[model samples]
Target: MRFPSKKTWILLGLSIVVILISVSPLLKDGFPKNHDSELYMVWLSEFDEGIRDGQFLPRWVPNVWVGYGSPLFNFNQPLFFYLAEMFHLIGFSLVLSVKLTLILATCLAYLFMFVLSKQFFGRHAALLASSIYIMMPYHIGLMYERGAFSEYLAMAFAPLLFFVFYRLGQKISYKYFFWGSITVALLLLSHNISTLFYIPAVFLMVVLFSKKILNII
Candidate 1:
């Protein structure tokens, strides 16, 4: 069977440590138990039921809005609930699951920032970028106070999406295109408001980068 290499394990360990530190406030309370955090928990029932019934992707939340229901799965940012369910399946309490999802997103943001930066600058620059990212006040509020969980999930993918798009320009490959599209789609699914803001910047960057790539070539 295929397995993770030693270096992969080392990176995973280091990432876990960094992510835990980012959510250090959570360790004290075992994670926030109320506010906007609670609404996400209220939505988890459908996901839990869907998992057990083997109905893979949920389409509706049948018990929302005083039981009138909602097309939650149709419009909700899915990655948060999906990641939270994985943590739940692994036996964490629901609150902990949501918190862990945030931690996981932080880990990805750090890891991808490091990787993408290393390509442009070097290892030291990558470390600096990742450090700055986790240390930023906006990230702190998003995780600790604002409880902007879905947006956090989307943020992790946004940088990676841009990096993958840039890589596609350097080396034309179907693999790069496939992964790039998936990243863009994930960003779109992450948050409607965020996606609205992202679309214009994305199109502008594509045009600008395409021109730069052609000039360099």
Candidate 2:
């Protein structure tokens, strides 16, 4: 396999550094000590059972709210827990899976920011933007303190959605439209609440960016 160039390596190292500094508090020694973590484990325990019963696509988490379960799965964000469950299914422990998901989310956020920013701005600007994305105050709070895993994962897709939108605007073609639709779907699946807020931002970008919205409409 070919190795990355020195510049690639440097950017990658910067991404890792930004991610680590953002979540440094959680890495002090152990997992987060909080009610949310316990809730995650409980949800995963039931999720594992459903998977064992051949319910490959879980729509309702059967016992989450003190045994009086609602259709929480139907509305809850699936991407983060889906990843964590995949880890558990593949033999990693539940808690470790959650930690890994947070780290993976952090990495993907930086990488995606770098890609989207580089597409419009220069490499130096992209690196700076990606670093800022990593160290955003609310982002750090979510991963280190609040433990809102799925919402945190949603951050990476925000820029990617705009990037895909730019591509679709660049050419009124089938392929870009398809990919743009898929990106929107992924963002919605990751976190519906974030998607709701993203809608206006997307339209605002359409208005601001060289009037690209005209091409699509």
Candidate 3:
């Protein structure tokens, strides 16, 4: 196999550093915690039974007051629960489950941002942007203290959705459009409020860079 070039090695190294910084706080037990983390744990515990029975009970519940009735539960959409089901099947506790989802989302987002930046900006800019994003104070605060798992996951997918669209517009194809639409749908489902705003930002970027977009495959 061909070895990675120096630039590739450098970016990989930076990405590891960024991921460590992004996730370091969660490893500590001293930080303030989110109350919802407890509730989510209760919900996640039920997911495995749902999966085993071939039906999620929460879906069948009439009231679903735990979260569905509240603004927070419906703040965006129901995608987070669906995403969490995977961990539920694996028997992760609520706190671990939420953190796992957020950490995975954060990692994916950083990686995608790096790819997007490299595609649009350049390797150096991509590395810098990803580092800054992973190291951002708000993200750390939210993941550790606020326990904004849905927002974290949604935000992670946001960059990838844009990256796919950026590539899509360059060359129209069924796969690109379909996947782009799926990502948009997932984004909407995960957090509609964010998606409501995200969609426009993407549109403007495409409109503003119509020429350059055409050059990328």
Candidate 4:
């Protein structure tokens, strides 16, 4: 493996600092009290319990819907909860795990957006694009106000999906194709609604870059 240049490290450090600053409120005492914050916490708890009880892909969450047990995971996105659960398994509190999930997602959003933009627009523009993406009002609201964990996670993966497809367009390789499939699958697991919105955009990307794709096949 090759080490990144000093410039790359600097850009990465700056991006991390910006992302941390944007989400610093999450590190303070008590939860941020967003619309769906408590709801996600409950879901993460139940999901963890379900996993402990031997349910790998838990669809039915008991103790919800007035104890009737809603099929929440079956219909809703499960990626964010799964990520948070990994943090919980390592001994973090559920609240901290949730917060960590949000922070990790923001970091990923910055990293992927930076890489994707850098491919076409050079490092400086990539840094600007990623900073704007991380600090955008709606993106900030997703974590601190709306608590839309799944959607926020999906947003992080969206640029990754695009980057993968862009690479596949540039060079048709099994590695890129495999990762592209995984990215799409992750996006679907992250947020079905957002996946729906992004599907057409991905298709358009494929269309725009079809010549190379066609040549490789």
Best by TM-score: 4
Q: Candidate 2, clashing residue pairs?
A: none
Candidate 2 per-residue lDDT over residues 1-217, each given as its tens digit:
9988999898778767777887676575567674376677777777777777887767777676677776767777777778888888999877777777777788888888888899889988999999998898887767656767778889878888888777665666788678778878888878989999997888677666634566556
lDDT of each: 0.77, 0.78, 0.71, 0.91
Error of 4 at 185 (Å): 0.6
> How do all models score by TM-score?
0.81, 0.87, 0.80, 0.92
Model 1 TM-score, all chains together: 0.81
RMSD of each: 4.0, 2.7, 4.2, 2.5
Q: What is the lDDT of residue 29 in candidate 2?
A: 55
Off by over 4 Å in 1: 1-18, 33-35, 211-217
| Residue 197, model 3: Cα distance from true site in angstroms | 0.6
Residue-level lDDT of model 4, residues 1-217, one tens digit each, is 9999999899878877898798899889879988999999899999999999999999888998889999988899899999999999999999999989999999899999998998889888999999999899999999888989999999999999999988887777899999999999999999989989998998888768767666776
- Residue-level lDDT for 188 in candidate 1: 76
Ranking of all predicted structures according to TM-score, beginning with the best and ending with the worst: 4, 2, 1, 3
Instruction: Name the Cα RMSD for model 4.
Output: 2.5
* Residue 163 in candidate 2, Cα distance off native in Å: 0.8
lDDT of 1 at 17: 71
Q: Best-fitting candidate, measured by lDDT? A: 4
The pairs that clash in candidate 3 are 41-94
The lDDT, on a scale of 0 to 1, for candidate 1 is 0.77
Q: What clash pairs does model 4 have?
A: none
